[model samples]
Target: MSVVITQVFNGFSLGSILLFVAIGLAVTFGLMGVINMAHGELIMVGAYMTYVVQQIFAKYAPQSMGYYFFIAIPVAFFVSALLGWGLEKILIRHLYHRPLDSLLATWGVSLILQQIARTIFGAPNVAVLPPEWLDGGVRIAGVVFPYKRLFILVFVILSIFALYIYLTKTPAGRRIRAVTLNRDMASCLGISTRKVDAYAFAIGSGFAGLAGCALTLLGPIGPTIGTYYIVDAFMVVILGGVGKLIGTVLGAFGIGLVSTLMEYSTSATMAKVMMFALIIAFLQWKPSGLVSVKTRSLD
Candidate 1:
C-alpha cells in the first residue's frame, strides 16, 4: 500500500508536468486547429534557458541558488513567449485553417530549432541540479515523497487554477474563448481574431517552457528531450477534449495514474504500448474526447 501511494505521488508529478505541457497544445490546437509540432521545441528552449540561467547564477551568485528557480520561472515564460510570438508572426500565422500544412511547417521549424540547439548547447545532455532546499523528501505516514516532485505538483495545480480563473473571469480571456468558439462570429462582434491567436500561441508556448523547467527537476535535458514529451502531451490533449482546461487536468491525472500502474506491472515499453492501446479504445468510445466543448455558430 505504501508502494502504491508512493507510485501514485510519482504519477501525479509526471501528470502535472504533462498537464502543463499539454495545456498549451490543447489551447492552440483546440482553438485554432493549428498543429504545432514545434511546441515541444519551444519547451526545449525553456530547458536550455533554465540551463543558461543556472550557469550564470552558479558563476556569479552561487549563494542564491534558491532564488534562481524563482527567477527562471519568469525568464522561461518570457523567452518562450517571445519565441512563440516570433513563430506566430513568421509561420503559424500563415498556416492557420490548414492543420496539415501547419503540422508540416511546425515540424520543419522544430527540426531547425533542434539543430540550432545542438549547435549552441551541443548534443550532450545537460543536468539541472535542484537547489539544496529542494534536495530532500518529505515523509507522510511513512511514505516519502521528494520535495522537488511535490513542488512541481503544487506549481502545476496553481498554474492550472490560475489559468482557469483567467479563462473564466477575465474580459480578454472571454474574447479569446469567443474567438475560439467561432472566429467568424467573433470578428462580426468586433473581436480581433488575429490578436487572440497571437495571445493563445504566446500563452501556450509559455506553458510549454514552464513544463520544460519542471521536467529538468526529474532528469537531464537535451535538444531532443522535448520529443519525449510531445507524444504524451498529444495523448493528453486527445484524451481530454481540445480547448477544455478541465478535461486536460482529468486526462493528465487519468493517463498518469494508469501509466504508472502499468509500468509497475510490466516493462516500460509494454506499459507504453498498453497505454496507447487503451487510448485508442477510449477514443473509439468517445470519438470527440472525454469532454467535448460546446460552441455556437454566429450565423
Candidate 2:
C-alpha cells in the first residue's frame, strides 16, 4: 500500500515536470505550427535567470534570500519571453509556412544558445539553493510528500488555470485562437496575425521559463540542462495532440504514471523503450493523436 502511494506521488511529480517542459511546445508547435527545436534553450535561459537572481539576492540582500524566488520567477519569464519575441521577429516569423526550415533554423539557434551558455557559465553544472520554506516534507498516509514537489504540482495547476482563463476570456487570446483555427479568416476579420503570432510565441516561451524556474528545485542546472527534458517534452506534446490543453494534461500524467510503474518493474532503459513502442503503436492507430483539433478547410 505504501509503495503504491509513493509511486503515485512520484508519477504525478514526474508528470508535472514533463507538463512544464511541454506546455510551451503546445503553443509554439501545436498552435502556431512552428517546429522550435530551440525551445529547450529557452528553458535553459530561464534556469540561468533563476541562478542569476539567486546570486544577486545572495550578494546584495543576504538577509532576504528567502524572497529571491519570488523575484526570480518573473525575471525568468520576461527574459525568456523577450528572447522569444526577438527570435520570432528576426527568424521564425519568416519560416512559419515552412516547417522543415523552421526546424533546421531553430536547431541552429539552439546550438548557438548552448554555446553561448557554455562560454558564459562554463561547462559545469550549478546548483540553485531551494528556499528555506521548502526544505522539508510532510508525512501523509505513511508517505512523505516533499514540499518542493508539492509546490511544483500546485504551481503547474495554477499556471494552467491562469492560461486557460487567458485563452478563453481575454480578447487577445480570442484573437490568437482565431488565427490558430483559420489564419486567412482571422486576417480577413481584421486581426493582426503577425502581432498575434509574436505574442502567442512569447507567451509560450514564457511558460518554458516558468518550467525552468520549477526545475531548479529538482537538481543542479547547466547549459545542457534543457537537453535533458527536450525529448520528454516533445513526446508529451505529440502524444497529447497539438493545441489541446486537456489532451496535454492527460498525456503528461499518463506518460508520467506509466513510466514510473514501468521503471519500478523493469530497467529505466527498457521502460523508455516500452513507452516509445506503445506510443508508436498508439500513433499508428490514431495518427492525429489523443485529441484532434477541429478546423474547417477548403476541399
Candidate 3:
C-alpha cells in the first residue's frame, strides 16, 4: 500500500513536468498552428541554464545551494523566453500557415540547439543536487512521499492556476484566446496577433524552462534530456486537446496515473509501450482529441 502511494506521488510529479511542457505546445499549436519541434530544445536550454547557475553558485556562493534553484528559476524563464521570442521573430513568424514547413524548420532548429549544447556543455551528464530541504522524504499516512515530488506537484498546480486566471481574467489573455479562435478577426479588432503569438510563445517556452529546472531535482542534466520528455509532452497535449488548458491538466493526470500503474506491473519499456497503445486507442475514440476547439472562419 505504501509503495502504491509512493508511486502515485511519483506519477503526479512526472505528470506535472509533462503538463508544463505540453501546455506550452498546446498553446503554440492551438493558437498558431505551428508544430514546434524545437519545443523540447527550449527545455534543454532551461536545464543548461540551471547547470550554469549551479556552476556560478559553486564558484561564488558555495554556501547558497538552497537559493540557487530559486535564482535559476527566473533565469531559466527569461533565457528560454528570449530564445522563443527570437525564434518567433525570425523563423516561426514566416511559417504561420504552413504547418509542415514549420515542423521541418523547427526540427532543424532543434538539431542545431542540441548540437550547440553538446559543443558547449559536452556530452557528459551533469548532476543537479537538490536542496537539503527538498532532498528527503515525508511520511504521510504510513506512506513516504519524496519532498521533491511533492513540491513539483504543488508547483505545477499553482502554475496552471496562474495561467488559467491570466487567460480568463486578463485582457491580454482574452485577446490571445480571440486570436486563437480567429486570427483575421482578432487582427481586424485591432488586436496585434503577432504580438499575442510572441507573448504566448514566450510564456509557453518559459514553462518548459521551469520544467527543466524541476527535472534537475530528480536526476542529472544532459544535452539531449529534452528528447525524453518531448514525446510524452506531445501525448499530453494531444490527449488533452489543443488550445484547452483544462484538457492538458486532465490528460496529464490521466496518462500519469495509467503509466504509473503499468510501471508497477511491468518493466519501464513495456509500460511505455502499453501507455502509447492506450493513447492510440483513446485517440481513435475521439479523433479530434479529448477536447474540441471551436474554430470560426473569418470569411
lDDT of 2 by residue, 132-223 (tens): 99999999888999999999999888888887888899999899899998899999999999999999999999999999999999999999
- Enumerate residue pairs that collide in model 1: none
Candidate 3: where is the Cα deviation over 4 Å? 294-299
Please write out the lDDT profile of model 1 over residues 74-145, one tens digit for every residue: 888789988998899888999877888989999999999999999999999999887778898989989988
RMSD of 1: 1.6
Candidate achieving the largest TM-score: 2
Better of 1 and 3 by lDDT: 1
Comparison by TM-score, 1 against 3, better one: 1
Question: Ranking by TM-score, best first?
Answer: 2, 1, 3
lDDT of 2: 0.92
1 or 2, which is superior by TM-score? 2
Using lDDT as the measure, name the better of candidate 1 and candidate 2: 2
* Candidate 3 clash pair list: none
